[model samples]
Target: MSTADDLKKLRLKAQIGITTVLGLVSIYILLTQPDNSSLQKWAIGTLGIIVGYWLK
Candidate 1:
């Protein structure tokens, strides 16, 4: 209804979209790799979490 409300809605939509995309990408990456390589994926996932937090 108002400008602030509109901006908040947009931000929420963007966050949801980005989170969904990230989840899919992570799943794809993990599935494509070997079991032995999971540790590396966990490390990268940790770093991604940290970076994503900082970004927010």
Candidate 2:
């Protein structure tokens, strides 16, 4: 593959990794913390995933 294709694959992998981490963290927070801020964190995490996909 070309360098450009390699770079695109790397970028996509990074984005997926970040989104997965954020989603896991958000789920952890929601499950462990029964508070108001968990909701906000979850929302932010969801938004991050959306924006990540949008950017991709």
Highest-scoring model, lDDT: 2
> What is the Å distance of residue 18 in model 2 from its true position?
0.3
Pairs with steric clashes in candidate 2: none
lDDT of each: 0.72, 0.75
- Model 1, 3-55: lDDT tens digits are 99899999989877777777666667676777768754774685588568659
Q: Report the C-alpha displacement of residue 18, candidate 1, in angstroms.
A: 0.5
Please, what is the TM-score per model?
0.62, 0.64
Candidate 2 weakest ten by summed lDDT: 34-43
Candidate 2 yields a Cα-based lDDT of 0.75
TM-score of 2: 0.64
